[model samples]
Target: MKKKIHGFIEKIIENDIKKNNQMILRTRFPPEPNGYLHIGHVKSIYLNFTLAEYYNGLCNLRYDDTNPKKEKKKFVNAIKKDILWMGFNIKNITFTSEYFDILYTYAVELIKKKLAYVDQLTKKEIHDYRGTLKQKGINSPYRNQNVQKNLDLFSKMKNGFFSEGTVCLRAKINMSSSSIIMRDPVLYRVIESKHYHTQNKWFIYPTYDFAHCISDAIEGITHSLCTLEFQENKKLYEWILTNISVSNYPRQYEYARLKLEFTILSKRKLQILIEKKIISGWDDPRIPTISGLRNKGYTPESLRDFVQKTGFSKQDSLIPLHLLESSIRKDLNMKSIRRMAVIDPLLIIIENIDLLHCENITVPNHPNVPTMGSRKIIFSREIYINRDDFKEYADDNYTRLTYNNEVRLRYAYTIKVTRIEKNKKNEIIKLFCIYDKNTFKTQPKNKKISGVIHWISKKNVIPTKFYFYSPLFTIKNPDLEKNFLNYISKKSKIKKNGFIEKDLPNNISCIPYQFERIGYFIIKKEKNKLTTCHQTVSLK
Candidate 1:
């Protein structure tokens, strides 16, 4: 389904702009470059950028790099790459650090107006004073620092006079305010550590609550959009900009973030998984990070299409994980080429091979699309079929191979099973069959063969690896669990060696192959070369 641009926020933007003749619809995608961007962030990026495009307004890709302790250059680079890969042409790139001087001026202005004060409370003291929802907070003892004294102390702190965690600047809002976030949220904190962008230029850093709205106002952003989790912080966001006397402050709007089922989008939890070595780094295909999904061969078109299908809404809901899978399946079904692969190989030898010569079958790459072209597949006397396709003894309803039962081999002749050989463990090792040439593209004349199977010519097959992926967690709602790692699936991945059609295009990028009767498989790369093929989804 195509996504429609009909959210209430869009309407609000249009109406507000029309009401104010001089106003413009400018927006920003402010991502804190602390970790790799996940699918949850994708929705926000799409919304902000698309809204700006639809309104013929300016959209900036700004990094809210306030927390120097967690921000990094690598994460920043990864973020830029992810956005570009998703097909967004971001014209303006800005950073909060770029406006550090301006933001510092605003903070000083707040202090001069007696709306903000430098606090000497310890970290725990601050938290304990910040009462819970049922209680009212208490003002910090140092909240009354005079303008001149506060200005000197704040300057010294910024000039590296104060040690980290000794003091912080706070807003002078009412302690008894009903909005807990308005009860004097921290505006700036002293951090002696170096930053990726600023290096050791300063010892103090502005907090997100202070910097976010101030930066938006400084850039003349018309709509300050964020996820609903920050609904409480909207009060503080407005307070900072209003108290600073900014000429035009952006209005903040909150929308529900993507909470996908069977997936966890919390960067902290994802870090834990990486530190614990539960899966590979952030690009592990099991996780839903943009890089992880890209590694799993998800197309940017599919991602954009998926985002569009889930229209903007204020309500939060857990979307089924299959909705994402369905998007990729829809795209691949039309574009992906077709081939035959047999994993868990069972060798089948034709009994009358001396009489029945081998043949070549020209099969279309796509069953429904002729322009996709065709690939030549060998139909030899000896071939490898999937072990699951055959049974030593079967019920009448079995649609696949059984002893003495004739079955149709996809794109080739029909074969009658004659015998089955077993190993010492009583496992079926091999199959012997006879081909009926008259059933090449049609069923038998006398009766119908219910069984239809897929095979690869053993003589002309290339052994390949197939990675079968399952849900990362055993349960659907692992995010709600106390310890999501407890539900990590033991069988999340199944590795099988298969024989695929020989001479598949080498050195080609992530092209999906439909393994005849099997599911779609995308090539897995090792240093930009094909290493194995991963099954994207099951045929069913």
Candidate 2:
């Protein structure tokens, strides 16, 4: 049995290598450096890198930086950081701009073969000629231009003779084809904007369709993996490669991108949010960006597990945010220390108690993971509890501090609510309770309690500002809408005043915690030492 198992594994490995010999199944993650990567991009990066690892292949971090107008160095750097944070190391790094001369030569070759031509039609006119969903489409007048004229015009385009968008080089594909991508797509266009890498060496730039395939060929990439949205363009991608004399013909494969509820994955919409100041930036914690998830205390292990469980599917699916959060909490629970914090503080006075001696309450860092050990908490006469935990009216089912309710002080003793103190306005200002110290569990007595609550020392409570973030948009699907900006929610906010226990010293840094009974939180170090965490509960 053991010999057979090893044989099967070896056979699979041998087949993978035999099928892709020279390049060894090389894959490239070609992201346009226009914005920071989001959760969907995370899925793509993980899938590409992991597949490379699976067949003992190589993965390259290739930037599809064709549109220099929207691309930036900051976005490229942030993308690199996000991929690294997700535990992927791409040794071969490249950019589409690096192969500009080679791609221009390829275009010249296509023109020499009369497969492409220089189009004089304006951008709007070209779009109109391409036809709409209800139209059969019309061909441009320049489609049948002379091959020598097309070559000369293309060279002039590279020489900066024409202004941006005045002329464009397009493939002479069938205009009446049902597939919209086949309708003589623009191969190259005049972009007078200064590029970050290539600079002013050329005035014309290749479109994504023209540049991407050439880039893959240049890197000797064997597998060009992308999202399913490009399925229609697969033919065009192959056409570009078949026309060019490349040593290896890379195959383009597409998979459905990850879609999550209560989030927007559209880069354009996300960019609008940043430009309009609807979000702090692309890395805003509210955003589904890789940086945002990292800042939210999500472990790389959790992200990997999420991608693994979701797997690769041909059809698009909407993943619930809770599924991702559950994965994060499952990992964090084993590592995060249990801490007590009162978000909405209410004074609790344990009357008839002496404050001279401070009691030490020992609590384990993790209950099931015993190796984490324990910490000491100082207990005193007065402490702060959540304001929502107490109420003036209640039914028999109410176990917490109602008018005269009885509850246990967690690891301490049981306490009975004796009276309620209020101001002249008849507000429930304070709760007066008497502790039955004899009923302590370690030193037991004949007493019982209905419920227990988390409390922090009033004097030890640190007042810090907390930033609470929610979904950036009001709609469930921000990408589906024609106007993404109109769905922006005004309720997404940042609060600067919140409190936590003083004993949590290490938490003063940008640390995170699973606040007992209140969901996860992090100690944010903005202007104030605030505890910022996402609220798991919803308004619904």
For each candidate, give its TM-score against the true structure.
0.96, 0.92
Root-mean-square deviation (CA) per prediction: 2.0, 3.5
Kindly list the per-residue Cα lDDT of model 1 for residues 1-540, writing each as its tens digit.
433474878788878978986776799999899889999999988989988887778899999999889999999999999999999989999999998998899989999999888889999999999898899998898989799999999998888889999999998998888888888888999987789998988799999878888889888999988889999998888777667778877889888898888889999899999999988898888889999888777888888888877767899999888889899889888888888788989999988675366677788988999997887888777889999998777888888988746788987888888887889999888888998877778875696787678888877787778888888888888889997889998888889988877757764455777777788777755674445888777766
* Model 1 residue 440 distance off true place after TM-score fit, in angstroms: 1.0
Best by lDDT: 1
On TM-score, the leading prediction is 1
What local distance difference test score does each model get?
0.85, 0.78
How far in Å is the alpha carbon of 220 misplaced in model 2?
A: 1.7
lDDT of 2 by residue, 411-500 (tens): 677777788889999888888888877776543545545588777776667775555667777878777888877887777765644456
| TM-score, cand. 1 | 0.96
Superposed on all Cα atoms, model 2 deviates from the true structure by an RMSD in Å of: 3.5
Model 2 spans > 4 angstroms off: 1-23, 355-357, 442-446, 494-498, 505-511, 527-540
